[model samples]
Target: MIPLLFENLSIENQPVSMPLPNGITLTIKREDKNHRFVSGNKLRKLKYNIAQALTEGKDTILTFGGAYSNHIAATAAAGQAMGLKTIGVIRGDELATKIDVNPTLKFAKMCGMDFLFVSRSDYRYKHTPEFLEDLQKRYGSSVYIAPEGGTNTLAVKGCEEILTPNDAVFDVICTAVGTGGTISGLINASAPHQTVIGFPALKGEFLNKVINNYTNKTNWHLVHDYHFGGYAKVNEDLVTFLNVFNKNTHIPLDPIYVGKMIFAIFALANKGYFEPNTKILAIHTGGLQGIEGFNKERIKKHKSILDYEEKI
Candidate 1:
């Protein structure tokens, strides 16, 4: 509401015409179109964070992320839109010189996010007081710090708003799990009969602890079957599926997050994972911003690139 960064964004529960089992149907919540830059869960996570920053009289916003992180790009644009100076603590120092070639970082730079590139080792201490103090020393302490991936209590509260009273009709709620904020919100707001499922973009059961901290609901479960070799990892098979999914549904998905979630959802639906007379709602948490970098990497590996977006 402060400077109105994302205005006129509302719930768009668009149904995807996927030919699944006869008893089940799949629909998608178009949270991705919330904003040009600050779209999807990124927008939800930033909603309260940005509001609090303004309420506290902070003039700057600082966040952490990887070179190709969607959070970094969204933060930079949201801060620019809200008239706040922004800083990005990038994980890889080497990417400092490659901003021209990196789409995510390039866009962040264009949005006026001051870049503080550090080595991977140094980035590991990003949570420690020493590291945070060093950052505050360089860029005033008034900077509202949104932790990497933008997953925090305030962010979780914003995400809980994703499901509306209309969404209660659906039997299952689904989302892609990154830092676990989106699904946690879904879990907290889910009806007793509604099951919340998370398709993790990264591997490991450690995210259970992260989600547990956000909500006390036990109706949610994470499907670890679709990591496809881990975070940011892709293959020819996945690319093939991505191309076909976009061609069929006309809903473009990012390689890292949405693609994996949709792929998993479709596979499960086809395999009769959903019982008869069941409805599944998946959150289209946008990350299409990373499509360019993902395609670039695919091209370098001599693999087919995902045709999710126009050439970068």
Candidate 2:
């Protein structure tokens, strides 16, 4: 029998409140604090992938991600907890002599994941058949491959569990789009009374194509303006917002993806895009460990001293 490490996830309905700028109240499902996986989204995406690996009689799993990818860390943890061997195909070739360990990578190593670094050019071809064949030859045929971010049809099916059925009507469902898996799944699971809004964390028009290719739904729209500088990049406003958000809600949102999404949601709501009484559920996709690399001083100089306070 496959181990049932993920069956006891706690579901907490996050608070709904009005924002300062526009006064439109939004309901947020803060799945980021679901468990040690750091987010409900991670749990949802990884649950079935791990199950499929074991069911198919595969003892090893191969996947792709950046050095700081939450998916990589989650995969490593899940693999270790589930008795499956894990290999992380990292983008970039600088893993050997890294001066400082990014927290995510450090945790992934602690989970017993083997890392293989590839060039940027080669990393782009990760989903190709040649890459899979090479990995199979290197790791043997017992390895099952999960796409980067665990964004697959099965992953989407897993994410549907995050949405709870409600009698109340909602106009829009918003989420940060990274690999487009969660948002695509949201689009699939949402009712016709709601429209799914995706805030893309990457550049270019490729996300639209990715979403379209995965699902035929036309109600989903991608907002490309609020990445705050691409994936893993941070700006002053985002940092300030993150700090204030953490202070107020005690919910830590990683500045790369979730932070940007929340920022965009506030911005759009303030601009009067959302009608009065329109319910908005912002899915907090989690990557809390990724926040370790952020320089608190550069973002909030006045409050940097708080970082030194001993936790009680």
- lDDT score for residue 165 of model 1: 88
Which RMSD values do the candidates have, in order?
1.6, 3.1
Residue range 1-312, candidate 2, lDDT tens digits = 334776765566566443545446666776776667635587788778888888899998789988678888888888887778899999988764551456667788888888898889899989899988999899888999999999888888778777777713567888888888898888888887888999988887888877776688788898899987677666667777766776776666777787798888888877887887677778877777666545433445442322312121
Span of 10 residues, lowest total lDDT, candidate 2: 303-312
Clashing pairs in 2: none
Candidate 1's displacement at residue 20, Å, is 0.5
lDDT of 1 by residue, 50-152 (tens): 9999899999999999978999999999988888999999998999899989999999999999998999999999999998888888888688888999999
Count of backbone collisions in candidate 1: 0
- lDDT, candidates in the order shown: 0.88, 0.76
Model number with the top lDDT: 1
